[model samples]
Target chain A: MDYFLELLIGGLTRGSIYALIALGYTMVYGIIELINFAHGEIYMIGAFTALIVAGVLAMSGMSGLSVLILASVVAVIYSAAYGFTVEKVAYKPLRHASRLSPLISAIGMSIFLQNYVLVAQTSDFLPFPNLLPDLPFLANYVGFIGSTEFIIIGTTAVIMVLLTLLIKFTRMGKAMRATAQDRNMAMLVGVNVNRVISNTFIIGSALAAIGGVLIASHVGRINFYIGFLAGIKAFTAAVLGGIGSIPGAVLGALVLGCTESFATGYVSSDYEDVFAFVLLIVILIIKPSGLLGHKPTQKV
Target chain B: MSTLNYTKYMEGMKQAVVVSLWFMFLTFPIMVIRVNTIENIIEWRWMNMLYIGAGSFILSFVWRKMSGRGISARKESIGAQGGRKFYLQRLVSEKRLSLPALGIVAVIALFFPFVSSIYQTNIMTTALMYVVLGLGLNIVVGQAGLLNLGYVAFYAAGAYTYALLYHHFGVGFWLALPLGALAATVLGVLLALPVLRLQGDYLAIVTLGFGEITRLVLENWNEFSYGPSGISGIPRPGLFGMEMDMHEATVYLYFLMILLCIITIFVVNRLQDSRIGRALLALREDEIACQAMGINKTMVKLTAFALGSTWAGLVGVIFAAKTTFVNPASFTFLESAMILSIVVLGGTGSIIGIIIGALLLILLPEYLRAFGDYRMLLFGIIMVIMMIFRPQGIVTGVRKTYEFHTEEK
Candidate 1:
């Protein structure tokens, strides 16, 4: 029972991170139908931004809570700016070209951003400062969960709820939905499709930034390449939940997280990555639309 | 008129401001925050950022002016001199000079090693390997219209097959090469069987996953692959137990790759003109419509995977024989991306185009080593710029049509 709970908590923590990053991927795919491959690099940049901000704060002897809050905000802003530029330079120009052009351009952008960071920062793993406030009282109540895990899960839940509310009630959310359904019709109805797409990139990238900061802090070490595998796994999670669905991405991420955690706990951890990809292939083979994805009707 | 000119000047100023803002944001983290040392000391280079911002604003302004007038002027001239434009197009396409061009190229390639240094010869050999790989990929991506992002998996399969066979059973390079290619072929067909129903992006992701799986498995299977130390001491390919020296070996491998390149080009060109090639092209353009016409999508797609993997596998064998080492590191997603870029950058489905694309891409990075660390960065930028400016590719392929004729009634 203890092992199961341990695995469950660990899985949920990791899953929340995947869920956040996957939300960015799914939202972009929903709006523009292009896998914003550089979103992973955006997540990496967010983590680095947080590292810099936290490092600066630590030098000034600021309180941990204030540093965390300020760092997250700065990271989100920086990452969102990257998302906007990537869309305009890499994607917007090739919006009407053949399907492969945008995909290749996205890959090119991903390579460029990765190397850019590698040249700008140290390629070796840098230890991320743990800024979570240590609460002695929580130790007695929570057996398996650490304060960091609690914060990560708690923050993710709050974000998810807020996101749900935003999508459910906001005018921007309705416009996003309309644009996603049909770009031409949405434009004809006076929806600013371009603005919606840009907003989607910003929101999605900001969410990815949160995921980046959380995961980097949780892992306590980060390198230039951390986002590559994380991005792939999160993309798998998004697809597993059904590519365009928001809640589905979170659900898929949780399931994937649990699978990875339990598999590492029970099986040889060497093959941990193998399991996620095999699961993807199996899921794709059996149900191509994913668990929650609706079947796309062909116009023929 | 004076007021209109002022308005134009204001618009240009607005454009420059936007471009400058974009450049600053893009270059800020990379330029300003130079995290140089292990202690994580923040090294700021504000001057570099300023230069980049200023340079981009100037370039953007110039680009705007040139495109504003140059494009329309060229279009009008081309419209006026239609016959001259057609003649120029034919010359540019190499229709008139193709035979002579082929002869010249063949002569240059054959004598290239003797004229160049041994180091250059080796680089040329590596470039030729990519030519074969590029040509193979061109068939699947350019002709069949299938997006495969995991081609390196098959390349690894071929190399490992040769390595394992030689390590365990003491097989010769000559015998193992074909067997290794066969192994890759089987892997490709087996992979295609389950995922043949998928189209476009999904297929790409699955293929990418499979490629990663191959690498991961190779990395983890310690007893078989030595787990990352890699298998070494694989014998070089030679004739009748004659172990040639390094120079001789270079020439031999060069010729072998050239032969392979020629065979690939010939086979691909012939296939493109064949019925099956037509079927593959149809599948690429519209799978449903082709299926309606009784063309078997499954069969065509399988053939594409089989033939494309065969070329990759053959090159893999050559790679192992040349390096005398086989490791999971050699086959990465980057290798797959580079090959795909060759096909995309070259006119997709253009035979001669793939060769030129492979050479430029492979050799440019080699020469750009003088540019130091910015080689790959520049390569990535070039890819994006190329896609934006010419998404069809640098060398567009010729579209061949088969006309149906009815006998006189």
Candidate 2:
């Protein structure tokens, strides 16, 4: 029972991080219908930015809470800037090209950003400073959940609620939904489709940055290549939950996280990654439209 | 008119400055700062910012001009005039020019081993292997429009088949070659079956997952795959039961690659005009339309995967023979990316383009050791730029056209 609770909490923390990253993918796919392969790189860049900022602030003897807040804020801003720039430089130019073109370009951009960071920074994993402080009230749950895990889950829930509100109520969110539904119709309705797309990238990237910072601090390690696996897993979550569906992305991520946790715990950790891929393949074969995604009707 | 031109120049300069400034800001955190967390030291490279600022300033101007020209050129090409034919295409079409060119290339290839050092011969052999791999992938991605990101998995299967065959049963290269190819073909068919109904992007992800799964399994299944320590001492192909030293073997492999490359080129060239080739092209353009026109989509897709894997398998066997070893690391996602880049950069569906692309990409990096780290970075940039400005690639594939005549005319 203790082991079960431990695994469950671990899964939730992992799921929360995946959810944060998956939301970006779902939102971007919602609007453009292109899998932004470089999104993983954006999340990675976010972590690296946060690490750099926190390191600098720590060296200058700043308070832990202030450093954490400042680093996260900077990371979010930088990641958003990167997301916006990547879409402009890579996707914008090939907006009308065949579907494969933008995808290939995205893969290229992903590779470029990975190597760019590798060239710019050390490839070796850097130790991420512990920024989350333990709350006095959470002492009883120490065996099952840590302070980091609690904060991650709490922050993710708060963010998700905020995101839902933004999408459900705000004018920009309405514009985003309109564009995702029918790009041409949205344009006709004067939704400023390009602006909506850019906004989607920004919001998604910002969310990913938050995930990156939280996970980096939790994991206590950061590296240039961390984003690729995280990105793939988050993408799997998005697909599993029915890509382009916000609520579905979160739900899918939790399921995937639990699945991975239990599989690794009981079966074998060697094939931990293989389970995700296998699950993805099985899901794709069984339900091509995903659990929540609608079957797209082919138009002649 | 002069005032208008001056204003335009000034506007361009202003945009360039803004673009450069944005880039400098974007790159500041990563490019300009290095933080040592353990040592608690901060190193600020302010010079990187200047370099980025200047680089983006110049690049922004070049980008604007090229995009302007690229859009107009693309429009013209899409128009009925067929636009200007690339010189490479013209060379391929005109028998007069192509014959002598082919003859010169053949003579140079035949004499290359004798004239150059064994090192050069080995590199050329590697490059030739990529040429064949590129051509094979072109069939699936270029001609069929199915993006198989896990193409390297088949390559690994082919290699592992040979290594394991020899390790267990003492099977030589001659027997293992066909057997390895068969193994890959079977795997390809198996993969193709489930993914046949998938959409394009989903297929790419599935294939990518498949590739990763294959690698992970190979890395983990210690009892089966030797657990990433890898299988070694795989023998090179022998001729008529004769024993040869390393130099002779290198020369032999080079010639063998050249022969295989020629055969691949012949098969691909023939396939392009063949009925199935036409079907693949049609499938690439529009699957629904092709199915409506009576082409069997499943069979065509399966054929593409099978044939494409056969070439990769064949090369995988050759790769094992050349290196005398097999490892999961060798068959990585990056290898698949490199092969895909060859197919895309060379001009999809263009045989000569693949050949040129393979040689340039493989050989240039070997020669330009100074830019070793930048190779992948450049490849990524090239892919993005090509998709944006010249998605048709360096050498565009010309479609087969027929002229119709009437009695009245």
Candidate 3:
């Protein structure tokens, strides 16, 4: 029972990270109607950025809270910028072009970024130092109950609540919703559609960056190609949650994360990937719109 | 791209200059390598002139220009809506062949096998294998409009099928090929049942996962697959109980491969003209429309996946025979991507286009050893360019039996 509880907790932790990344995929897909295949790469950029920031700070003898704060900020800013540029260069031009144009372009960009990193980083795995505050409470309750699990769940909840507040109340958040609903109408209402889209990429990418930092730090190893599988799983989570719905994406992420966690714990680890994909296929077969996704009714 | 409008007089001057430059570029290398036979063919500069200056640039230009002419001529032939359709038909008719003449040439060339080198023969064989794989995938992507990013999984499945069976039971090449294809077909149908409803990128992601899963399974399933170490020493195909090791030149195997190619072409061409092909085309053009037209989208799509995978399986058997080994390394996501590139690089629905696309792209990588690392980079750039200018595909206007095979909307 303890091991089962532990597995359950572990699953939710991974799921929360997936939920964050899924939000990015779901948001971009919602507004543009194009699968941002490179979204995963953006998540990758965040982790790599955090790695550099942490590595550089440690190298310069900055070790504690200051190093943590500096690394986190750098990761968020760098990821957001990368996301914005990716939208501008890869996706913006094909906005008016045929639907397939942007998709193919995104795939191309994804391959390019992956290869670029592969060349730049020499395909080696780097260790990420933990910058988390080693609170005694982890040992007393969280870690005593389950360490990684509680950290994941607690961090994810905090992030999710913060995200919920930001989207529901903030001015930029309102703009994003308006843009997603109808670009033309939103533009007429004086919403800067381009700004909103860019902001969405930035916001989504920032969350994914946070997820990346946590994951790499937790796993203690990072590499150029690490984001591919994580990115795909998150996208699956987004899809399973009914893409474009943030809360749904997060819920889906948790479910998927836990499912894989359990599968790895019980079934063969070799077959863990098969669970998420098979679930995706199953969900798609059962409800094409996803778990919380609305069915789009065609007028014609 | 519109920078070509640099004043008509300047454009005219540029064309003349380019034509002159092309001649000079073509001659300089040939002139330099004239002293040696191997140098003329194998020298880097000479090959570049042939690959970049001649093969890619010239071919791209010709196709672009032809498409331009086709667009205009199509306007003259029919209405603007039929422009694409008309151009392709005209292109196909123009490509109509005098097979008897080629057949005589082929018969005559069979006598001169002693002159061809072993390295050239091996290259030819590899090209043949890819052509088979490319054509098989063409059925799914070109005819059915289903993008398979994990085609190599099926290929791997077939190769493994042959390896496990032949090594264990001493099954012959001819028997293993079909059996391997059958196994892949079963997997394809099973995969299709779940993934058929997915469109485009969702489908791509699922297929990608599917391929990865197969690879992971192969990598980890040590008891059955021997894990990453792979199965080795699988025997080569013998001709009618005669061993070919003592025979000079792998002439018999080449002939067998050519025969396979002929059969593939015949089957695919026949299928293209059949009712089933029309249904697959309907699914490609629009799923809703196909359903409205009374086509069973699921069955047709499953058939497509099965057939396409079956082809890959067949090619894998050949691959196993040639390599005399089987492993997970030979089948990867990148391999699937490469096959998909061939289909895209060629016009999706055109057989001749796919054939040329497969031959040129697949062979270029093998023959040019220096540009190996940068090949993938260049391939990505080319894909971007192809998507931008000729989203339809090179040689896209070629005739297809699909014209006569169109189902009612």
Residues B268-370, model 1: lDDT tens digits? 8899989989998999988889999999888999999998899899999999988899889999888998999898887688776778889988999999999
Q: Among these predicted structures, which one has the highest lDDT?
A: 2
* TM-score top scorer: 2
Regions of model 1 farther than 4 Å from truth: B1-6, B34-40, B62-92, B403-409
User: Which parts of model 2 have CA positions greater than 4 angstroms off?
Assistant: A141-143
Is 1 or 3 the stronger prediction by TM-score? 1
- Once model 1 is optimally superposed onto the true structure by TM-score, how far is the C-alpha of residue B150 displaced, in angstroms? 1.2
Candidate 1 DockQ, CA atoms: 0.61
Could you tell me how far off, in angstroms, the CA of residue A293 lies in candidate 1 after the best superposition? 1.3
**Order of the predicted models by lDDT, top scorer first:** 2, 1, 3
lDDT of 3 at A256: 98
Q: A237-293, model 2: which lDDT tens digit per residue?
A: 998888999998999899889888988988999988899889888998998877788
lDDT of 3 by residue, B1-409 (tens): 3565656546555554565455444233222221121222222245434444444345445544655664565456456544445354455545354355446646744643456676666667777777788889989877888877778889998999999998789898889989999988998888888887787656776787788788878988899998888999887887678756623426666666777877888898888878998899888888888899999888899999999999888888888888888888888766887777677766677776676678777777666556755565555555655555555566663445334566899
Provide the TM-score for each candidate, comma-separated. Answer: 0.95, 0.97, 0.79
Candidate 1 TM-score over all chains jointly: 0.95
lDDT of 3 by residue, A68-89 (tens): 7888888888778778867865
lDDT winner, 1 or 2: 2
What proportion of the real contacts between chains A and B does each prediction keep? Answer: 0.48, 0.76, 0.21
* Cα error, candidate 2, residue B69 (Å): 1.9
lDDT of each: 0.86, 0.91, 0.75
